[model samples]
Target chain A: MTSPVVEVSHLRKTYPAAKRGGTPKTAVADVSFQVARGEIFGILGPNGAGKTTTVECLAGLRRSDGGTVRVLGQDPQADPLLIREHVGVQLQEAALHDKITVAEALDVFGSFYSERADPAELLDLLDLTAHRHQQFGKLSGGQKQRLSIALALVGKPQVAILDELTTGLDPAARRATWELVERVRDSGVTVLLVTHFMDEAERLCDRLVVIDGGRVVAEGTPSALIEGLEGDRGVRLRFADDGARERATQLLAALAERDADVTAAVPIGDEIEVTGTRKVLFAVVQELAAADVVPDDVRTLERTLEDVFVQVTGREYRVEENEEVAA
Target chain B: MTAVETTGPVRVNHEGLRFRAFWTLFGTELRVWLREPTGVFFALIFPSLLLLGLGLAVPDFSKPMADAPPPWNEAPGITSYLPTIIALAVGTISLTTMPVQFATFREKGILKRLSTTPMPPQNLIGVHMVINVLALIVSAGAAVVGGMVVLGVPFAADPLVVLLVLVLSTTAMFSLGLLVAARAEKGQTASGLGMLIYFPSLMFSGVWVPLSVMPDWMQEIGLYLPLGAAAQGLTMGWFGNEGFPLAQVLVLAVWTLVLFPLGVKLFRWT
Candidate 1:
């Protein structure tokens, strides 16, 4: 087995309680995970979920309250100078001077490291070659995001930590960022990604940890976690009318009779959502045919990371207001 | 991962890092400051206006008193006021202009972005200090030459004493500016606070008015302030006078030692 490139054990961080007076808020509580060398490890959480604080600690930007975090086998806090040389960090709200041009910023940062990628090469890779002469303040949101990524990669670090890689990007830019991340991973650099986008996590992460209220509630490969749920399969059936909905409910009941582990039959709008195994879903479809209620739309889809997240944590995904405030 | 065997003490290549970081940031600051004529106007032009205005308004009061007074015999009024004005210009540029610049850098996360690299934080501070010190020197030279041509104030011929005074006063003011930059939370706040501290020092530190003309209690108070002592020392050195005020030099030195560490301790990158 390859050794873990990033190791965090029993990590904890606590912020001072608010002025109203209560217990101190635990930003990260007993969080632990390891990213194997050359694999992408993602941390998925809602806003105020301690994602930023956790990555800051890992990057040696903040002192950890408790627990050990080692990047490239060096203690980040104790030896930040050493770790900074090998670890590249792209903070969520990081920015540069308005008057400094993109190429100038890249060249300046490149001078800090012992070994660095050529600024021209990095600009091309990040699609920022054309905007090299543009001042940082003149760039659009997507352009700035691309510049931030270029700055992170200029040092050619062994481990790269990107926080909210595609937070405010349009769909097209988001897809481009995804491709860039995959290419980075393919180049043999370990990536620790912090994102709230479920699809992004499912697509990019080889293994992930779901964090909520400062703790890791679940951790595994996306597929493994989804499969771990008991009778976690889901079926969507759009019916003709209220009569079809009633008949679909009856069909689901018949299918549950065959499997003791079937959990729920929820009706949403004109569709009935059946949650159970592949066997139960197939039986439910046959029962619907027997009842002579032909469904208009019928499809069986695997449970997504979002579904598994909500089910395991009992909390809906919420985008916090402060997520955009940093920008 | 490849491992290398080492038998001797590990050495860090701080020279290369420091040199590279310093020049990179210095070049960036010079380019931005030059391009933004408005910023340069406010930083360099405004202070020059103040110096030329004050130098003209205050006449040679020390010369008339030179015939009667013991201390005034060697240092005349215009000669005394010249060094104080120079010191004030240095104070204005470093303490006021530099802090606001650094605060904006913090607001924009430029400093935070730099912190992620192998460059040490001291190099950033050092670059700012060096650039502002050079600006101060040029401002001082312009103020002296312009004061001579426009205000009829005579320039001192002794370059050695002028150089010594410039070195001491510049170091003292640069360290003070670092203290302000480290403490102020916002750019406007730092600029405002700098003016608040600077205006009073210019008024009571004998930059605009001689301490001898003020009440005895005011003169005693002026001796304790850093700029007041600096002005006193510069005046004594510029005119080839006796009684160099070792006590005042000691006080300024102490201020430098105390404020520099406190400034560094309080400094925030973001």
Candidate 2:
């Protein structure tokens, strides 16, 4: 494959102390990832997880204390003008003048680029044509988000960095924004998505890096990350009584001893929980059928990206922390 | 990408691109400024309106001063107030309009957003300066022309000298205003700080009490401040035959020299 469109390796950034004699804070410790062309690459992390810092470095808005970042084979800090011309950034909490109309905002930003996308086409794609004349301050939250996306693509940028693009949108609006993002990617623009939403990452990212405490804890496609969890799948079976449960436990123990897929079989209350590989469910049922032992009810647990995130970060995802740490 | 292929036809003229971006932002900002009634009224029309109001309201406002030097004594009293009004025009735009606009842009993250583009946020500051300076010129011109037609005020003895003084005065006042804008966190704070400095500037420029009537010690101090020096320099250029107002011009030059670079150094993009 050709070199990735965006390359970042061992990236580190530290914010100076806000006051004299205060200790400096490290926002990004060691983040390394490469985004291939035409892929929706995601930087997934909880609040204060350095996702914003990573993209800010990639956009040349912030200087990393260590490591290196190259967008379209140009160093962001060294060739910031060229990088800015080619990389469209949708920064979180960044807004246009309140009085600027939607179309005016797009036009002004488009004027900054040598090659511009058709504003009418972009507005249609983002479903913002009806609100083209609305002032920025008057637009609804979803409309504002969509306009931001439109501005990001108005330059016909080769790489677009969208930071928390759908953070405040409702479910329907978020879905629409996601579709617009997909369309942008399909139009030959490589997208670097920074988000704390696991579902967004799972649904949109071709590959993502899970960042925690300023470091990449896990990196893979959403399904691969979920599968990377060791013995994460399981089967739960409830029995009529403890007598049947005990018999089932013995049979499952025997199964576990013989089969490599059965990692564990533990009894909780009247239900015996079997934890193992994806095929463990079928293997456990076969073992029970051989003994003519039946389960009252059975359910299989499927791991999701959320579970993978929790497993990798060793903490629940908290979105309310307000990631203003970089400021 | 398609952009790369299209780039072949579009020659890499970096300077030309930057100039185009500048004019685009400049036009947009000028429109935004004009749309706001308060900004346009205060910056563009208030000085002339104040002149017209004072000319009509105050009795014997057009009479020649009884105790003034030479040709200036022969000129109408309203003409003596012209310098102060010109200073007021530059002061209002610089302190009240420019600083608040800049601080609010920073507060609202407009500057930060612009910084992500090829054109830096400093371009916006430069645009603000150009627009505000133009407002100052228009306001000063309106006041002078209005004074001539309504209050029988005479034109400056040397229009060139008056323009030179206005330029120096504008530079000094704008530098001071930019210093306030450099670090203010909010529009409210900037306006508050602006007013704090603005009232004192008007006082020193003798807006209420003519500098000629002030005690020698008071006038000495007033000559040192930017607007005060501006008022004195403008007065000298308008009516004085005692040669150029080198001392007042030097005072304004010092103010610009000290404050402009300091403001530029202290300014923050985000």
Candidate 3:
């Protein structure tokens, strides 16, 4: 890839003690990632997983305790102003003035940069044209989110950092935001998305890093990560009769004993479940055909990103909420 | 999907962009402040209204003072309170309007949000200061005009001295208010702290009792505080032929020099 647009190495950040003599809290332990130009790169983690801190370091809003961050070929710590000029950010809890109208917010923010996107075009793209004159306080949650997104894009930034962009949005709105992000990427801006939603990452991110406890657990495309969990795929088989079920079980057990690809064959009530690698279905059907014993039906279990997370982290994926204190 | 063409990044002159951002932000913030009628009323109109009301309604208000000195004896009773009302106007905006707005913006993350952009969030403080100072001038002007037109009060004997004192006193009061706005985490706390300072300063400014009638010790202490110094200096320049109250001017100058840098140091942008 042509030189990466963003690069971070061993980023570590710790918030100072809230009170005197109190122990400092570590927000980011060690994180490293890169985003190429024109790609949707995701930083996926649970609440308080240092996702915000990592992105804040990239935006030059926060300085890292230890490590290096380079955006658009400049060190963020040394040249924060230049970094801010080129990168657009939509912070999670940041809000506009209550009395500021949609158009006014866009207009004021747009004026901050030298090259800016057309405010009218941005408003139309985010579906906020009808509410352009509406006060920020009067808009619904989704509308506010869309307006924030519009503001982020108003500067025609080369990179956009969106934190929890669709957290409070409805299903339809969430889908719409995903499409908007994709469109933004297609138009040539790199996007760095921070989210805990597996589906959102799977749908939008061309590549992503799964961070837990301030460490990267996995990094790859959604499908590639899921495909990494080999030997977990299985097939459930039903038979025409009890005799056929017994024969199939014995045959699958023999195959499991001899074939390296077959992990186990277990019987569930009147059916048999054959567990093995991705080719388990073909292996089982071949074994059954050789014996001339056919099953009534067959079903394959599908592996999703959720299962991938559980396997990789060795813990159930549960959204630990309210842990972040807005650092 | 409709194709939204992306524009290429262009190199911008930082100084030029910051200059533009400051002016744009000033205009936008001023509009937001104006939309809140309570702030505008207290800062701009209330001072003159209070002056007119007291001048017309109080018994023997416009009648010449029956005190001991020539210039003092010639002026009306209401004229003695003119400086106090002007000081109160500055206090209203400095303590109540400005701090509350700053704290509310911090609480709402408006300042924090601005930090992410190329525009420095400190510009908000400068913008607010300009707006509040302008309001101060307008209110001070109205009170002086209203006093002369409706109450038959005489104009300041030393116009240049009055102007200088107004500048010093406004800066002093605003600096004090800036100290309160610096670290207040909540709007309620800011207003509370502002009021705590506000009422006592009003007392020292002789809002409740004319400084001439206040006890010697009280008057001594009043001259040291910003509003009190402002009131005493303004009164001397307005009715008296004295060049200026050097002591009161020194006091205000000291307050401004000390409080402004301290406020900026303690400021919490987030």
> Each model's TM-score?
0.85, 0.89, 0.89
Q: Please state the CAPRI-style docking class of candidate 2.
A: acceptable
lDDT (Cα, tens digit) per residue for candidate 3, span A84-143: 777888878647888889998998998888878998889888999999999898998889
Error of 1 at A34 (Å): 1.3
- Over B112-203, each residue of candidate 2 has an lDDT whose tens digit, in order, gives 88878777898999998899888887999899999999888989987887889899999998999999999998999999999999998998
TM-score of 3: 0.89
> What's the residue-level lDDT of B158 in candidate 2?
76
Off by over 4 Å in 1: A14-25, A231-233, A239-267, A290-293, A300-302, A319-327, B1-14, B36-38, B53-81, B157-159, B206-217, B241-247
DockQ of 1: 0.34
Clashes of 2: 0
Model 2 chain B is weakest, by summed lDDT over 10 consecutive residues, at: B1-10
Error of 2 at B254 (Å): 0.9
What Cα-based lDDT does every candidate model obtain?
Answer: 0.75, 0.86, 0.87
Q: Write the per-residue lDDT of candidate 1 for residues A73-97, one digit (tens) a residue.
A: 6678786776787778787775677
Please tell me which model should have the higher TM-score, number 1 or number 3.
3
The Cα error of candidate 1 at residue A102, in Å, is 0.7
Candidate 2 collision pairs: none
Docking category of candidate 3: acceptable
